[model samples]
Target: MNKNSKNLLRFAGIFGLIGAILGAHMAGSGSYAFRAVHAHILVVGWLTLFGWAVFYKIFQTTETVLTKLHVWSAIIGSIGLTVGMWLYMVKPFNLPEGVTLFIYIGGGVALLLSFLLFFLLTLFIKEKK
Candidate 1:
């Protein structure tokens, strides 16, 4: 597998880990709010972004630096938000509520940039010669 494919697989595994933990917690707590956010971060933020990166590589598509930055930023940011969710929603932490919100929102913005790049990349492609 290429670098991008590997990234996708890695992120998938991360998501799986998060999901397993979420499921285990849900069985006891019966509160799914955390589960829902975790699911979105992993499945949507990580998995979806990774999938796009891999697809782009498999198709031998070119990307600019900004696109690459977006991909990495999104992946890293998602991980951050995933942790935030665990700390704040899943289990209370020492972090203040405001700090938690900032982390989550920042991560979300990073994810938004990733998707924007995905959409922009899709629009500009080399016409098959």
Candidate 2:
């Protein structure tokens, strides 16, 4: 497996564990406060990352600058978005509103960019003779 695939899979596993724990915590506490955060963690962090990892493992694409960008962006975006969501919604640390908003928006933009790059990557897949 490619290094990117391995890294993504690792990230996905971590996210999956986090999401599960959060879900369990919510259930036990009877509080749905972390609902959106948990959902995003599972979807964006676990499922999406896992899917991307699988893609990289199955398809032998030439690694380019775009590939690096996409990999890093996906990882960073996932962390930023999930953490930003928690900070924004929960405000556990009572952080400034502006900071939380910026993180949330920035993370979302990065994730969007990752998606776009992934689409372009698909278009340039090396055909197996």
Candidate 3:
């Protein structure tokens, strides 16, 4: 498979893993304390990346530097936001609240920047005809 296909499948796998964890947590705890984190993981980590992967594949975009940056930024943002929110909500790691909040927001910013980059790249592409 090509890189774009790999990226999509990888994100899809992430989605499955996150879904399993969320399911187990809900089953065990019967609480929605981590619901927001779970949602973000599915949305940004899985759906957004998957969408981008599909876009790249369909548009025949090469594995350029911008794509690399987008992949890295998305991975970092997705993991950071998910972990940060988990820490903020679960307190399992005993991190300071402020630190966790910072991570969450920082991840959000990175994700937004990635999206903007993707948009700019899209604008530059020509239809494959």
Candidate 4:
């Protein structure tokens, strides 16, 4: 597997574990407050990262600046979005609403860029004749 693939896979595993733990916590405590967080963690963090990892593994993509940008943005965005969501929704640490909202929106924008880069990447894939 490529280095990027390995890195993304590890991140995906971490996200998956966190999501499962959150899910279990909600189930045990019988509170659905973490529903949105848990769902995004699984879908955006785990599933999306896992899919990107598989793409890197299967496609012979060169590690260019674009690739690096996409990888880092995905990781940062996933963490940022989830943590921001928690801070914004749960209001832990008594953080300012503006700060939390900025983090959430910034993370979402980064994640959106990652998706756009990935689409451009697919267009550049070479035929394996």
Question: TM-score of each candidate?
Answer: 0.75, 0.96, 0.85, 0.96
RMSD of 1: 3.0
Q: Write the per-residue lDDT of candidate 4 for residues 68-107, one digit (tens) a residue.
A: 9999999999998998898899887989999999998888
**lDDT per residue, candidate 3, 16-116, as tens digits?**
68867896888799988778877877787778878877777667667788878877787777778778778888898888889999988888888888888
Cα TM-score of candidate 4: 0.96
What is the number of residue pairs that collide in model 2? Answer: 0
Model 3: weakest 10-residue lDDT segment is 1-10
Which pairs clash (backbone N, Cα, C closer than 3 Å) in model 4?
none
lDDT of each: 0.67, 0.93, 0.78, 0.93
Tell me the alpha-carbon RMSD of every candidate.
3.0, 1.2, 1.9, 1.2
What ordering of candidates by lDDT runs from best to worst? 2, 4, 3, 1
| Candidate 1 residue spans exceeding 4 A from truth | 28-33, 126-129
Better of 1 and 4 by lDDT: 4
Q: For model 1, where is the 10-residue window of minimal lDDT?
A: 54-63
Clashes of each: 0, 0, 0, 0
- Estimate the TM-score for candidate 3: 0.85
Model 2 global lDDT (CA atoms, 0 to 1): 0.93
Best by lDDT: 2
